[model samples]
Target: MEVSYREEGVASAASSVAGRLVADGVPARLAGGDPTLWGEDAEAEAAVRLGWLTLPRSSRELLPALGELAARTRAAGLTNVVLAGMGGSSLAAEIICATGDVPLTVLDTTDPGQVRRALTDRLESTVVVVASKSGSTVETDCHLRIYQRLFADAGLDPAGRVVVVTDPGSPLEQLAADGGHELVLAPPDVGGRYSALSAFGLVPAALAGADVAGLLDEAAEVLPLLSLDTGNPGLDLGAALGGAALAGRDKLLLEDQLSPIFGLPDWIEQLVAESTGKQGRGILPVVGADPNRSGDELVVAIESDVGDVRVDGPLGAQFLVWEYATAVAGLLLEVDPFDQPQVAESKENTTALLALPDLPTGAPAFTDGPVEVYGAATAKDLPGLFAELLHAIPGDGYLAIMAYLDRLAAFDAPVPEGADFEQMTDAWMMADPLTLRTLLALRTDRPVTFGWGPRFLHSTGQYHKGGPQNGVFLQITGVVTEDVAVPGRPYSLGRLQLAQALGDLAALETRGRPAVRLHLTDRAAGVARLLAAAQEA
Candidate 1:
């Protein structure tokens, strides 16, 4: 693994921070699994969270079992692998499978169309891997129940079709045991964001025919270098990230210029944003973000070639090193990286909204074509609404486009038979949210970030609420053409998705952050009108 910073200011700041860390013996202490680095308040959580520090070595024990499971599933003719998980549980697997060039369907949203898409196709040869770190995540639980119901409805035994990965005593374990499903327990000491090397990440990837053993080997080669004071990429990268954030360049614009590992930036977004974006300070990661040479942003290229700050390595080593770097960044920021204090607020709000006799319907400022615009009470048209959202951005702040619609449907075209999902997703034509993101970035100098609804609720949600109050949010929701039920749950997937959007909006509003919601009465037509208006504006 190699980490380099070419900019003189960044190099100077990083060197200063690194020199301080060397004097404090931080590199060796972190490698030795010392939990007191974050001080007394964080010691308890850090003690357990530091397990990731040794995961490159200790996780070798899981290979044989994961290999056997993969072999058995393949022998049973289950070629279609779907991972139903959320946040850390799902992001790592998504990246691993994508990088390994394997086909793995990832279900990380409550969008009904997406759920229906996963269910209707490849039913006979499918194997669903249910992963949840705490086993109590509402989205994961909803997916599990829906899958079980659908499988039974199709005359398939749910027991043989479902496999679970979670902590030992989590509720999912008991549920898995009750249903006679195979259970893989992750390390109790490792937190979800830090479980990339544990069973949570490896199980689904392995089942989908990824190079699991090779990943472990790559990570092992990088392990010994992390403990040394000199030539430690993890320490150097951490210092650079922490120092840059402290220097008012907290908005990280990450580009995958030539990285072979697909979806790596998304994984880094979750790890860094959630780990350090707390206590009124943190790094805000913008994946696939445009270059903003402005004083407020830092561009890091995740490529094998070049950048101001470049990180290049094998996939496995990349995972370990980034995790180490995040932990180190957290120490520099004086925040507990392991704890996501504000993440549960939206969840709690969603539950309350769902329990209501009817979901709360707020009054919209105006209706333009098929879209209902809310917030900025003065806006009367789509262009006016777009202008209002742009006008809300603070000088040093950013604009976040949060789409609660189906990500696949937004960015992807229909794939031809035998065509790859990645290829379809990268097709020439762009969709509503992507077009809006591009237009908005072109319209402003501030950093712009686009996130899929409930997924970002897990990734950057913490940062939006807990980190800085300078964010201006634009949330988009649409009508669900065909809503899917969550079996035992009262709310449908469509309702849960809206509730999540509303809940997140409520959180941001409570924080006094400038936010607006554009409701699409007709998903296709509404987005078209909005984008056209944006173009005209």
Candidate 2:
């Protein structure tokens, strides 16, 4: 594809950024608690900064081991692999398989429907890759417990079928050790978002039949170009983006007009959002969004050289390219690209919420009505309130739907599994957001985003609270009629889910963000009704 800036003055800035890359005299200073870049010293920032500098070499070093494991997986006759993770731990593997060439399904969402689907999938032969850098991510841990129970109930040995990816001493590392699960330790310096080239992404790629060696080689081949003082593709990209964002084009629309691996933008969105989305400024990377491109937007298209784009080049190489570019943008923005100060607030709030004895007992901030009517009230109720919120967006602002509803849990309401599962549910539950993105983009000259709660809390939540204050958030919460109890935790899945939703609302309110919360009577049906009403409206 093509990569160009829609804003002016970026070319000169690219040169300046290239110069800064060399002149800083700290090309590799990040790994050693260097603070000259951001002029701050925090343990978290210092420890996580070196991944991009050394991950390429680490990947090259680990090639043989990865290949061996790939052979073992093939011998095991695994036809499909399912990855259970969140945000950084999951996004890279997603890109590795986004072309649909990789026989993999990434279970990154906590939607019960998605989890149940994973539970019922080809468990007899499917390989399970449990990836998480933090080792103790709430979602990953809970998912592991769920799968562990399932494996036990089915008389299957999870350790023989599972692999663990994490740092050397993280909780998952210990879990793998305690359970005899295959383990791949990521380089300790690498942050989750930067761990793609590390075993995190490589193992999955190797298992998926991608040339892991070629990917690393391609990544190494680009090092010379990326380190250059001028005309470096990756460095220049950083300059263009950083320069443009500083010039008020902060909404980066990352498009691949001709790539089969179109989901590359999803990974990039997290990289850009989490890295630079702090200090009251950040790049809002748009993935799969192609409507109402505004004047304040910068479009960066990643396409193939000639025909329709596929993952022809080493994906590992592209990962480094984007990492370098995003780091450069962070430098230009004067924000620490390594630390997420706001992400912890949601987690802490969720934890506090989990300790509670019951769900929030107060009335919802707003409710349309009892969601009993199937066609009229069931549909019109949500859309009516949504329209009010949509109309209230500030000038040059975007609309964000923070859906805290149990997307798949409630929908599992005794419906015939095969006769209507595919037809009854929106394809992948994506229609609601895609439809809203289309409608909201038309209704207002601004972008529209749909974030499933708690999941996005780890991905884009930092941007919502700590980045630019230009979002009009609409929250959808529902009664969790059915719930799954975390095996050991004091609370149930329904409680954890609602805590995350309410915790997010608290975080938003803590930031004084403009928001509206609607408590729905039914989780899955409410979303369907909302979409239907929007269509009719």
Candidate 3:
């Protein structure tokens, strides 16, 4: 792995941090799994979470089992591998599969339409891999219940088609064992985000035909350098990241277009944001973001030459290095990288909202075409509502668009029979939330970030609630045309999704952040109007 700090300020700051770390014997202590780095309160969590430090070597034991599972499923004609997970459980595997060009369907959202699509799409030949660090993850639980029901409805034994990956003693483990399903026990000490090298990440990726062994090997090669004071890619990158943030460059603009690994920034975004975002201070990662747009931003490119700092390596090494770097950054940021305290706020709020008589959308401030604009704004149209939202941005703050709708909402149109994968993907993006995000970005000089709902709830939702308070939020939610029921739960998937959005909106408002909610009464028309309004804005 190679990490270069080019700018004079960043280089000097990083060099100083490296020297201090060396004097303090940080590299050796960290390599040895010492847990006192983040101070007294975080020591216990740090001790348990440091399992990731050894994953590069220790995770090799699971390769044979993972390979066997893949082969067994393939032999049984289960060619469609669908992963039901969220945040760390899904992001790592998603990136790994995408990088390897493997076909792994990720069910990381609670959107009713999305869930229904996964349920009906090639169900006969599908194997569902349910992953969660803790067995009680609501989203994963919903996925398990729905998939099991679908499998049973199709006369296929859910036990034979379902695979579980979780901590040994988690509730899901017992359920999987009781149901006679294959279960892979993850290290109890490893946290979800840090489990990229653990069973949680490898299971789905390996099943989808990614080179799990090669990933571990790549990570292992870079492991030795992490213990060195100088010439250590992890330490250098961490120092640069932490130092830059401390020097008022708290907004991290990540560029990964030139990296061999695809979708790396999304994984890194979750890692860095959730790891450091707490106590009202943290780094906010903007993926595929532009440069020189703001003074408080630092550009870090992974295996890309066009950035203030460039970190280059194989995909496996990249994961391990970034994990190490985030830990080092936590020390500099004076926060525990292992714990996401504020991540539960939205979850708790969602639960509360679900228990209410109805999904409390509270009242729309006004109607804007097919969009129901909510929050404290008098705007009665899309453009006016958008203008008000933009005007809410603070001088050094950013704009975050949280979409509670299906990420595939724009891909409802059928593609031509002969359309290639890339072309189909392009067409999808053109009509997706990304198009609206691009238009909004052009309207603002400040950083603009877009995140898919419940998915980001597990990712950047931490930063949105616990990080800097200067953020202005624009939340978009759509009406569910075909709501899917959660077997044992009273609320449907659409209700759960809406509750999540409302819960997160409440969380942001409780933090005194400016937020606006645009509810889509008609998904297609609302999206078109939003896109057109943003273009005009």
- The candidate that achieves the highest lDDT relative to the unseen native structure: 3
lDDT of 1: 0.88
> How do the predictions measure up, each by TM-score?
0.96, 0.87, 0.97
lDDT of 3 by residue, 346-447 (tens): 889999999989887888888878888889877768887777778888888899999988887778855668999998886676668767777777777888
Q: Which whole-number lDDT from 0 to 100 does residue 172 have in model 2? A: 90
User: Over 4 Å off in model 3, which ranges?
Assistant: 414-427
Worst 10 residues of 2 by lDDT: 371-380
> Which sequence of candidate numbers ranks them by lDDT, best first?
3, 1, 2
Give candidates' CA RMSD values in order: 2.3, 4.8, 1.7
Tens digits of lDDT, candidate 1, 1-537: 899997988899899899999999999999999999999999999998888877878888988988898889899888999999988999998999998889999999999988888999899899999999899999899999998988899998988889999998999999999999999999999988888889988999999999888888889999998998999999999999998888888888888868898988898999999998898999999876677688878778887444569898999999999999999999999999999999999999999999998888688888999999877557778887778778888988999999998876765444557767665654423454667888878888888898998999898999999898899999999998899988888889999999999999999999888888999998877777877898876
Better of 1 and 3 by TM-score: 3
- Which candidate has the highest TM-score of all? 3
| True-structure lDDT of candidate 2 | 0.70
Question: Which pairs clash in model 2?
Answer: 1-303, 1-304
TM-score of 1: 0.96
- Model 2 residue runs over 4 Å out of place are 1-9, 12-35, 42-44, 291-293, 304-314, 365-384, 405-431, 478-482, 535-537
Summarize candidate 2's per-residue lDDT along 167-204 as a digit string, tens digits. 88888988999999999888888788877787888776
